[model samples]
Target: MLIKKAVLDGIASGDIDLLFRTWDAERVHAGSTQRTAIGVLAVDAVEETDPAELTEEDARRGGYASLDALRHDAETRDGTLYRITLHLAGEDPRIALRAEIPRGRELTALRDRVLHMGDWAVPTLEMIAAQPGVRAPDLAAQAGREKRPFKASVRRLKELGLTESLAVGYRLSPRGKAVLSAVRRATASA
Candidate 1:
């Protein structure tokens, strides 16, 4: 209810803090304004950021120091989290609704629940299950589709309650793991 939207300018390559802030997203001309919701909490780990308007250094100034700094910052701001949506002013010219994990929330767990279900919830879960560590775009590439399909699939998976995200690409829920495990076991038994 007390949500304040923000933007970190000049973000070239960086990561998202999927801990506290959880932006309710829509992919418009700016970041995440497509009138869509992914329901997953995922932070982007920018590796090669290059926004036409924003720069990588600008990203660092906005709120990305290092693992330790980010963790400390998020930990301290957990209660007063400010949701942010990341967008680049580069070729894309539109910002992706970055994250809502800022410093506080009315129901933190709810935000977590939404984040648990991400842009590519199911595939992302499988990728994480297989690799335990992967990237969002990697999942997208593996999905063999463009950005929208990959992002949308993950959103669907989140809507289905099978997966959620936390900064990392994605992880399986108890239900998801159970299902995956069952499938694996059945295949092995067969």
Candidate 2:
């Protein structure tokens, strides 16, 4: 479920508590948390709902100006209508993780993890570092890999706090730079 930046801001501000999506199946469950640029959102409930059953208040809580606007937007997608109740959970842990530079055991563990990602890891990091705001397809073409797998690889790096997604592309986080330096030194010695 992709929440828009505006809606995310609303969630963070406690002004929004509901989300409506059209999906073939439920994409999120009650208790599942989604990390967004703003922070983390905790899903409190997920239930099938009829558009007509949705009240104007529901629209407001969902960040829509009116029920008609909500219905209009929901109708644009094809799937079962699901009403999701949610709240801002907390800060995205990655925010903290991306800021911290690893050392000693942690550094070694992170380096090993990157090495296990195969030959593409270091090069990908270097490429992102070199061209911080390039589009993914362009980066993928430069790397001679398909866009999907390349994106997945980047996501893995992001999970490790070694990358930050930009509005258009990505850049190495502080942790990423530290890890990359450590990895380069270790590989050079080996």
Candidate 3:
């Protein structure tokens, strides 16, 4: 639902456009990787069902009906359909309340270990988060870097519990994002 909300936030408002502008600028400037990841995930997680085609406020109302049908379909197919209804199709706090999602690439000192972190930190966090819950190596490799830098950089994040271990790599912890949301909120409010 977070992913879905992120998509809605982008397309529904101009947040997606702002993100694209920032991402395009970032690519032109320096931190293309983070911007790229954000853009891609935003694009991919967006529902395949076209909101434009659906049209009207009916799309919003149809959300529940659509889920009911999907739920029934999943039940018949011997698949886990509640997951589709309850998880993905559901509204998310972070996405619905954009205040929870931090904008920009500002890094503040939450941990002494990460105080003077590298330029990659903010973007890395965004990248890891865009896919939330991948492994360290894969997350690093996903951002277009190598294993060593990815592993080294994720140390402070690990300490902060922003990421967790997978069989081969790492993925984001939900709590980590909640922390990020708080930090972003504090900064924005300030």
Single out the weakest 10-residue window by summed lDDT for candidate 1. 92-101
Candidate 1 runs further than 4 Å off: 1-125
In candidate 3, the residue pairs with backbone N, CA or C atoms under 3 Å apart (3 or more residues apart, or in different chains) clash, namely 10-16, 133-171, 133-172, 134-170, 134-171, 135-169, 135-170, 136-169, 136-170
TM-score of 1: 0.35
TM-score of each: 0.35, 0.92, 0.34
On lDDT, the candidate that comes out on top is 2
- Model 1 lDDT tens row, 18-82: 22232233112222322112222223332221122343444455555544554454455323333
Winner on lDDT (2 vs 3) = 2
Instruction: Please write out the lDDT profile of model 2 over residues 6-90, one tens digit for every residue.
Output: 9988988889999999999998999998888888889999999988798999999999998999999888899899999999888
Q: In order, what lDDT does every prediction score?
A: 0.43, 0.93, 0.43
RMSD of each: 16.5, 1.6, 16.9
Clashes of each: 58, 0, 9
